[model samples]
Target: MAASSTTLTLRERWTRFVDEEMSTFVFSTGVYAAAICAKEYKELQPTPQRMQQALRKTGAKMPLITLSCAIGIAGMKMCILGVSRLREDYTRSSVLVACPVAGALLRAHRGPRAMAIGALSFGALGYGSDYLFSMWHRRNADAEEVRYALSLREHHNVHHNDAFFIETLQSNAYLLEASQK
Candidate 1:
């Protein structure tokens, strides 16, 4: 049982790692391709030869962009996971710990000032994203719980007014708060 559970955890972690890596790769590639197309549109002559050059340039650059994104995101995920393991909990703190390191690495080639800016920017983004996601999940869970309780109450009543019951559920404070966006 212990062995199986350990294997399951390892598998899940590997899945998460690969998922992040692949998603980052795909997203970066698409964005880069779009940027390349836009640049070609603005700068290149509208000729078959120019179009071919644009295609060739995109093909040449895509692998580099894809690899960079995949490796960078993978490294960031590893840092987050390592922090979570050390802290014995997965929380926003893990993102806070990882984002700066990832950001620093991202701008290291540009020297100290750029690296500092990147770290600060990435840290802020990570903090904001984590906070928003946590709040969103909490609201969703609260709304779901309210719905379940209301449903159970509905099932127990023999002569309840359907319209009134629905109105009551809709007016629930949790649901109201959740609905506020």
Candidate 2:
């Protein structure tokens, strides 16, 4: 019972993993979409034939692009979480490299246009996740933290502005700093 209490169950861990993956799907898909859109709509006015070609290409590439995006988001989340521990996050860094590397690979097998999708996604999602999580922490008060640590650990749905997020992040940082002492 003691051991079980200390470690997360498989279901809990899987749920957390799934939560992170789903939260960032929009950014990942956006990355894929941007590249696909750009490639598909390069010309000022596209013909019906051109539209069909672009749709076909973009559709075929979406799976790989989405996979790469999901990979990137997970890597980014791991890096941020590791940073919270006040140590080097080598694992996150390594995992994150997969995003661009996969993109480059897509470029090799697909086209330059396909590569853009991955690269864009890496930039958009990688950089954007910091903001996404900051937004999450901002909305939840210290009460939320207490509930999660002592009670059920679930994400809060309420949201606040950037200022709130910054203030909460600062307060959390202070708490962390004090804890280290």
Candidate 3:
């Protein structure tokens, strides 16, 4: 969800776009496929005729599932991307905006109430996910910074007499202390 940067080559952008879209679509398809399998197993017998009918039903549904998943996932991602770009940063608000659009698309056929419920549910999920992810990233970054600082301190200790190394270590320590505050 990083903002698209000017440094990204056209090829890199295209690759990222394809990778994100395809992965989401594949995941959606897999979930739907599993749901279909469960439904078939629960409702039908194992007889050859029943199995054949199930197979036909599966075959007919697969294409629609694939197409709908691909389109739906792509639409959601595109909306998120657009919102992120417009906001000039990847934030929970961007996801908050995008999820309602996706929810409306998903539940529009059900009626306004369904759409509103879907939008509220999806928006809450998206916002919570974004918040949790950001928290995780922040924690990881802090740990990494601490690790780097420790490594630098170890190096400085080994080169105890090196003024520049000692000075650099002290500066890093000061920065770390400031950050913790």
Q: What is the lDDT of residue 113 in candidate 3?
A: 94
Q: Which candidate comes out best when scored by lDDT? A: 1
Clashing pairs in 2: none
Writing each residue's lDDT as its tens digit, candidate 2 over 21-137 gives 676677657866777866776465557767777778788778777765665555555545655455554554454444555444434445678667757776567557756665556
What would the per-residue lDDT of candidate 1 be over residues 1-181, giving only the tens digit for each residue? 4666446587787887676566676776687577776566534466877778777777876765565455556668789889999999998678788998777665555578977897898888888888888888878777776787587776777455767666666667646585556
Among all windows of 10 consecutive residues in model 3, the one with the lowest summed lDDT is 37-46
Model 3: per-residue Cα lDDT over 58-155, one tens digit each: 77778766765665566677888898888889976776788877765555545789778877887888888888887777666765766786677686
- Output the lDDT of residue 9, model 3: 76
Q: What CA RMSD would you report for each candidate?
A: 6.8, 14.0, 8.8
lDDT of each: 0.72, 0.60, 0.71
Q: Lowest-scoring 10 consecutive residues by lDDT in candidate 2?
A: 149-158
Question: Candidate 3, TM-score vs. the true structure?
Answer: 0.51
* Native-referenced Cα lDDT, model 2: 0.60
